[model samples]
Target chain A: MIIIISFFSFILEYLFNYLLKKTLFLPLITLTTTVIVRPFFKKNNNLFYMFCFILGFLYDLIYTGNFFLSAGIYLIIGIIINLISTNMPNNIFTSIFKIICAVIIYRTLCFLFFYINGITIFSISNLFKSIYSSLLLNIIYGTLIYLILYLLSKKFNIKRID
Target chain B: MHKKEKNKRTIIILSSIILSIIIATIFIKKNFNIPSYGIKDGMMYVNNIITRIFGNKDYYKLEKENEKLKEELEQYKDYKSLNEELNNEILKLKETLSIEELISDREYAFGTVINRNFDYWQEKLIINIGKNKEIENNMAVISNGNLIGITDDVSINSSSVILLSNHKFPLNISVKIKIDDNYIYGILNNYNETTGTYEIIGVVDNIDIPQGSKVYTSGLSSTFPSGILIGNVEDVTTDNFDLSKVINVKSETNFDDISYVTVVKKGNK
Candidate 1:
């Protein structure tokens, strides 16, 4: 199940990246989908972390060519989500909120990385535009994924591991 | 007690992985030639198949249009060769009277865009042709008879083009505007993100360039061939110190719909 979900997430990510290559807004569909479905396998923490690392590493290798950059970013996100999940109630709203937070944090780190690498010149308006558009698309995609997973779990009688 | 131990172990593992990733990133950054192990090639192959299967049909339509345009271009090439022969005859006549020959040769190769960088602000494109096709760094890429960008990185089967609109690696091209018998010179520098236009600087304050004046490459630099159509002057304003005027140019190439481009190379005839 974990492997299937990870592969599906990768396909979704690749499709989105190809479709929206030139757009300012990038949807973190794979990360969001993984986060939304994570509650289903809450007992398999090690498997989940490994899955995140592999997904991120493959993403960097195939798309960005930045080596382990996305791997590190995905691991950081996985850690944060895991930490938060321990305290937060498992619900659709919480899933959406967590995904939003993750997206924001990841984008901030990316911005800082690009700034340090001198790839993007610092412009306040451009930064704000990037943040807003990225947040908007990610939130929409995250919400949809959460709703779909919630419906699937209810329909299939899947029990939460916790 | 068992849960606490598991959590501690997880933290240790996560930290080690992160540390290793950071070290690997640094190492890869220093070693520039590390092969991608066929990952990039495989991904491109799959992507090409997917695009062919489920992608937009407009690309096919555009390919047909391009074929028609190529035919027209062949007709123009014949006319150009005849005109060049006449000019060479005139130059030969003048050479007998002690004038120097000034004609140079240029070669062009066509390529299709295979990929583009996902960074919105960075205008970089990857084309299908590469080092095997004699493509090299600094070759100018043109689309729709206008300058698009120059080649930056070239691999065995692909090359990355840095576009003119890129802010990080903005290109400087010498440009000119002909007014009656006089030619006005200026340097096109950085792309302004706010205004979405290329900033033209260093024009003499005396030359009053009218709005909608055509701008072309002055060919002062070896990076790009001379007289390639760049864009038209949209607006001109004086700088803060009043020494030179700041001109904004609207680029001729429509970046959104670029499908095919010709890489221009300068060589001996």
Candidate 2:
């Protein structure tokens, strides 16, 4: 199920990028979907971690030139989200917040990766402009996804594993 | 005791994962020739199908117009005279040098763009032809006779091109501007994000480089052949700190609308 969700999310991302060329913000649907599905498999934490790593590896192989950077970042993020989600209440607002936080963290990591690779965009204003645009779109898209997931869970009566 | 054991196991797992990531990164960096042929082929196949189903109709009309214009330009009588004059000057220089001159033959492979990188900041595009078509790294990629980019990573059926507008490791091209009877040389580097143009730096302050003068690749590097049209000088400003001149170049290629490109493969001279 996680793999299927990630695959579809990747396709959606490709379509969005292909159609909307100039849009600064890109919603990371795959990572967000993985975070949303984590609660359903809380007991099997190792399997979840493995799934995150594999999904991230595949993403890197297809999209990026770097091999392990995405995989490592995703694994760490999955762990962080797993820890937070276990303590926090699973609701629409909190879920949306979590997705926003995840997107910020991912973008920050990407910025750091760019810096390390010596592709530093010198102006702080420019950096913030790109980040804020992307953040705004990610939040909007994330809210919609969260609402859909909330409705589906409620209708299907899916219980949390913990 | 149960909680303590679980915490210990969690810490061990986290540490191991970090260690594995470090090792993997190092390994991949050292052995960089991992050909992602299967993934690229799958992506190209899917993209081709999608584009065919929902392709832009206007691109075809533009391509036809571009071809027509090129044919018309080639038939101009003034262009023939200019070509003859340039060839005569080259022959005179060769005689003066008293050395054997060998012209490197270039092979062009035409390809269609398959995909573009997802990141907005990264200036990269994937083309359909790759190692299968003898396309290798550092080959010059031109669109409609204007320089666009250079091929970087190649798979079996696809190759990724790094554009000149890429902020990362700004591609340094040696360029020159002809002024009356002399040519002034400078290095083109560091794209100006605000102005959306490339700046030619390190030009001597004394040279009178005119606005609207053309910039061509000096062929200092083997990757790109000399005489390829890069851009035109839009504005020139003197650096306040240093006495050098900074010339702003307006690129010839419209990056947004590039559909087809010709990859030039020059034989060893």
Candidate 3:
């Protein structure tokens, strides 16, 4: 199920960024990470971390050109997911909150990394714009992916943590 | 007591891992770029096939329209010939004055934009041609016959281009504003994302320079070839000290709509 989601996310990312050229309208890549958050607690946490490492590594390989930078960033995000969603009950409202937090965390980490490396100039306005520009699209994508996974889990009798 | 201790340990371990990764990011070589060329190109190939099958259904109609436009454009041949004669006269005068710069042959490799990286620094484009097509770093990239960006990282079959609109990098290219029978050179430095224009700084004070003057590469900088159309000046202003002029240019090339690019390399003079 995770692999399928990742594959579709990859294709959709290409569609949005390349064919449609609507990257400003939709951030399907980052929001798709939310799918694995629920499965993290139900399974072995180490395996989940490894999955994120591979996903991030692949992301860097295909897109960013950096080596393990995204891998590490994704690992950190995985930890964040575990930390935030560990105690919260699984519901639509909580899912929205988690998605919002994840987008902020992802953008902040990326901005900080780029700013520190002198790859991007630091500006409070740009940071807020970056965060806000992606928020609406990512929230919709996150909720859709979450609901799809939820339905699939129910149909397949997959064990999910409350 | 035991559960709390376990959670604390887990947090410590995760934090340690994150710290180590951050340290690695700092120490790692910035140019240690290993892009997955085959995988990306393969995906693009598939995408192209899919797009061809499902997209552009009116290809024949567009071709017919293009042919009709070419026929209609034949009436302008006299004007074109007159312009060519004037250009030849200017070249002859320049040669007689011994101020003519050596012009080199330019070779262009056409490629499709496979990816647009809209990540944090959203100014990169991945093209399908790279070292295989003799694409090198700093080679000028253009779309629709207008300057767009320069090649940055070249892999086996793909290369990344850093667009002129990139504000993160202080990549200054020498440019000249073409006025009536005169040219004023300046440095194309900054890009204003909000205004969708480029800021040309270090321009000499020219009070009579009108808006909509054509800007082109000066070829003073070795990175780009001369005479490539950059844009037209939209507005001009003086520095706070009123020493040098700052020109704002609006490029005809739509950065967002870039799908095809031609990478140009200058040959020997």
Candidate No. with top lDDT: 3
Model 2 alpha-carbon drift over 4 Å, by segment = A136-162, B20-35, B57-105, B112-123, B143-145, B167-171, B180-183, B201-207, B237-245, B254-260, B267-269
Ranking by DockQ: 3, 1, 2
Model 2 Cα lDDT, one tens digit per residue, B1-269: 97997898688668756764575456444635365568767877667766776677568887999999888987877789997898788768878998554333367889987666444354678788998899999888898787788997788888878787777633677887766667788998867656768888899849778888888777777666676777889998988877899899987777766768889875543
DockQ of candidate 3, scored on C-alphas against the true complex (2 decimals): 0.37
Which pairs clash in the backbone of model 3? none
Which stretch of 10 consecutive residues in model 1 chain A shows the poorest summed lDDT? A16-25
Every candidate's DockQ is: 0.31, 0.29, 0.37
User: TM-score (chain A) of candidate 2?
Assistant: 0.84
Choose 2 or 3, whichever is better by DockQ.
Answer: 3
TM-score for chain B of each model, two decimals? 0.76, 0.74, 0.77
Model 1, range B12-120, lDDT digits (tens) per residue? 7678566746754574446342465367666666667657775775688879989999999989999999989997887788678885523233578898776654444
Give me candidate 3's TM-score against the actual structure. 0.80
Candidate 2 lDDT score relative to the true structure: 0.72
lDDT, residue A113, model 1: 64
| Tens digit per residue, CA lDDT, model 3, A1-162 | 677778778767666555446345546464456444556347466667667777877877666666666677777777777776677777767777877776777678777877777666777787787788677776777777778778888888877776
Error of 2 at A162 (Å): 9.7
Ranked candidates, highest lDDT first: 3, 1, 2
